[model samples]
Target: MSNGEMEERIIDHLRRNGKDTALKICKALAVSRSVANKHLYDLEKSKRVKKNDGTPPIWDLMETPDDPRPVLKTDTVEKVSEIVRTGGKTGLKAHEIARDHGLTRKTVNKHLHSLMDKGEVLKTDSNQWTSTGHQDSQASGDVTVSDSVLSKCFDIIGKLGKGAYGCVYKAQHKYDGKMYAVKKVKLTGDADAEVKALAKLEHTNIVRYITCWPSSQDWESCQDTSDQSDSSIVFKGSYTETSDYDSPGMESLSISTESESPAKPSQKHRKESVDPSNPSTTYLFIQMEFCERGTLTTWIRNEKKEQRTIIEIDQIFHEIVSGVEYIHSQNLIHRDLKPDNILFGAEGKVKIGDFGLAATLTNPNGAAIYRTKGRGTRSYMSPEQELHSNYGAKTDIFPLGLIWFEMLWELSTVSEKAYLWPDLRIQKCPEGFCVKYPTEHKFIIMMLSPTPHVRPCATTIKENLDRFFSMNHMLCQKTI
Candidate 1:
């Protein structure tokens, strides 16, 4: 084909698939990568397409014209009909149908109107078109197990746990048969942040992200709705506050010491007034690698019970720091850092899981930036974060300090944690433990410094641990 024809085909492909990398485009079009790149750059220069700075540059049409030209083909009508039918109850917007087939909005509307005349589809008040079928109606009763989006793709094993906003389900992929953790939460302004953060990260210490999709809230009833007991969900570890503690400089800090149990689901759905025209709230289902060993809280309890050595505890803490280092290297801050958010993966490797409050450092150099305060869990949150202050990567460091303390000491009871949590913040360690691991305690104090600037970065913390372990190993060898 001519150069002009090749560019046109590239534009058409982008319109149909939204975006693609040069390599994929070349393979799809049966053209050489060099040939595709040459034309793609030309179209980019002409402002007909745009390229994203990913590993393999992603190319997509910059924008379509106000009056798009109709895509000509012998079976255009059949294609449009198929897209509508597949859209099901959720339906498709004029633009969605148009872009899906590489056709113009006007062309898709013409086909939609024709289908309406034939009673093949109907447009809802929401301005979305859906097929005229009983199963595809808004008033259709509880979604059947076969028709539910969750059940269609996954074999629902059971509930994993509940979060502040939604519930996590343990499921097995119908095709792959591999287990996965799926989080289902109502769609909100910040609903996609976790997915975006997880998508950008891939590390041994970080949870593996699979994929995500949007589904109507109807999937709830299709799940294990019959079971309303607490046993239905995974039991999460608990935390208690250090009440009645007053320090000279720490009086201004508002640290919550109340018990924080995991959020639970309602036993039954509340019956409420229904607006037939109103649409159901959409929920986002994010699939991730399931960690059977559970959270760091469970791991810590087990280790304490087993009476593990300080050396073994250092290994776990090192792994956690390594994950934080990797996250910081990626220019991301996992604002909500705590034992509950950390998990043990398949081979019992530590993995950071929740990214609900993660923020990307817009600064290319990964410097501290101003952010809204009062985001993370109050107990594990840093003082700088508790105050209305400019924060950055250091916000994450404060929680790491608290986590390290949790690992080293055995505050197994609520009363013990309540009495010790405040003192630990002031770097007042118990007599024996402090003398034994003086270096570790000093580093922990630095990490928990009130001033964000005083706190060491994750990289520095990792290096300190590396040096300490190296020196300790050398001393042991000399004695032997």
Candidate 2:
């Protein structure tokens, strides 16, 4: 059936059956649960139906008018403005306001844009709506810049990037007057892991961590507890140039599995718990050395355009291996290693940064360490890490393998890279390319080995690279 017909069926069933659960609607209509849940959320967003706060939320038709595009009431618009006002610097999305106020998202948006035209509200770069008169009280009592802390010690130049976890900004220190990257992230239970890792790590190849301080601020979060295809409960909310290094769009998101039992509170209760008007979040401000040259991902994009030489690529890869070797020496595993996490410092030095997923080895003296299911960007994650098995330093090698392939091969466009990532993961090489660089191909294949024990340590890899560079230099001299 068409979407409109499916939705109409859902509404009619709810109207006739009175209050019902999503599962019951699915069974009654002979539709799949995902389809049922999606349509239910759609109805909720449109203000046609509402769900009670219970595990496996019970659905019910709202008392809204039959007209799909009814004009929003004056009081409802006032509530929207108040929600934005209380949101302050942490603005709210129009759909969030619509769900809270029992109005259609389109209706709420219409009024929000109207409010924007009247200078009563403003739309942020993030596309969130906020009141024009609202000002951050800086509840942390420290100097504030663009709604985040650390203006007292550093001059906020501009925002470098933002992620789902927090934001990174470019700042200049008051005393040193040197520019640095400051990452502002929400403080969660294990938030200290990243700070601790960065503090302990000191190397030429790694990003330098200056200092950090804790601060509190009212931050906005959007929670989606919708049922997903994976049968896991997802809580989506909006970490660090400290690119939103987590993803292409610069948004950082964490997906954790939750039980699918009714013992959990209903979605209605969860929604009610969130006060749309006054949401606050605690944060950590991390100060680190600023690399004016940007990330390796950026470097690759530029290289793709200008076509940098293999020798240059080799030098860069050598520096990256140097950084990874140092990280292993410190008994820390950088679970997330990719082009984005590798940054370029002044003079084009390679700096390994973003220790967000880095973990300390339980047995520092041992070669391998076991960790819980490793969580990092998908394409770079090792097979063992992705499988939630007992992985060690070799896990880091897996991503390094992918990075090596990306650095050396000329994939022209992003679409090409995306198309080849899967094949590359299995150690497949481009046509004739492997024959040209037989030794490099063999080394890459070793790193991409499925078995953790089969892969070499970062130290061993670095030694090989050093030897390769030495031989290559001799060969160049011979050619001359």
**lDDT to native, each model:** 0.68, 0.68
TM-score for model 1? 0.59
lDDT of each residue in 353-434, candidate 2, tens digit only: 8787777765546643334353677777888777543567888999898888887777786579778888888888788769
TM-score of 2: 0.58
lDDT of 1 by residue, 87-180 (tens): 8778987767777767765467667765654346777745678886522432353422223456577766556555445667766687887878
- Candidate 1 positional error at 126, Å: 32
- In order of appearance, the predictions have TM-scores of 0.59, 0.58
Q: Please list the residue runs of candidate 1 whose C-alpha ends up more than 4 Å from where it truly belongs after superposition.
A: 1-147, 221-233, 239-279, 363-369, 474-480
Residue 225's lDDT in candidate 1: 36
Model 2 CA deviation exceeding 4 Å by range:
1-149, 218-280, 363-374
Q: What's the number of clashes in each of the models?
A: 1, 7
